[model samples]
Target: MPNKNTHYKVKNLHGTSKDRYSKKKCECDNWLAHWRNNTKSQRTTCAVLECARKATVGAHVICVDGRMSNEWYIVPFCKYHNHYEKKDEYFLDSRVHLIPVYKLDGCKRG
Candidate 1:
């Protein structure tokens, strides 16, 4: 049986609740949209080396420090490499190089 108390515990993990994460995603849409529209090098090259696929999505490289970092390294990645369950393994093995997308001074991922 699922613990009824599990919900409270999860709310505190990584300084974020599941509800907060969802809310943040909605808030960040404008920032993402602006970035996609304004960036000159809308990266089409896949971060994974030797892959000829055109990249279409921004994939965040999870930071090593283990705290859910607001600072993220966004790499241009194809759909397959971005969202697959085995992405971490592929990243570790391939050591995908990421390009840093500079956040504009006034722009915030709120």
Candidate 2:
């Protein structure tokens, strides 16, 4: 749940390269499932601050603050927001939890 004081700064990764990871399998089946299993929360609306649409995909994003620029994180997103261009940046709601898309050892397992 959001703490109301911890907004996450994120940017969509390049769509073309992001698609390449679509077929990879994790213990939870898909990225969305991975997010759910890891966060211990149910998917509701898109993670974007004001988006009201139901979340349908686990969109890949990278932190824009440079600390984790090389790592990808997954957050729930609607079909529309999931297609944002790489240059698009947004502040995710404080309640939204980011799940690491990959592990240093291997793909993240549930």
- Measured by TM-score, the strongest candidate is 2
* Top candidate when judged by lDDT against the true structure: 2
**How well does each candidate superpose onto the true structure, as a TM-score?**
0.43, 0.76
At residue 50, give the lDDT of candidate 1: 54
Model 2: C-alpha RMSD to truth?
A: 4.2
> Candidate 1: lDDT over CA atoms?
0.41
Off by over 4 Å in 1: 1-39, 63-71, 89-103, 106-110
Off by over 4 Å in 2: 1-5, 16-20, 23-25, 67-69, 84-86, 103-110
Residues 39-108, model 2: lDDT tens digits: 8788589999889999988888887755454678889888888875536778898788778876423345
Give the Cα error of residue 44 in candidate 1, in Å: 1.2
* Worst ten in a row by lDDT for model 2: 101-110
lDDT of candidate 1 over 22-73, digit per residue (tens): 2432223432333344453454655554556777765555444243353544
Cα-based lDDT for every prediction: 0.41, 0.74
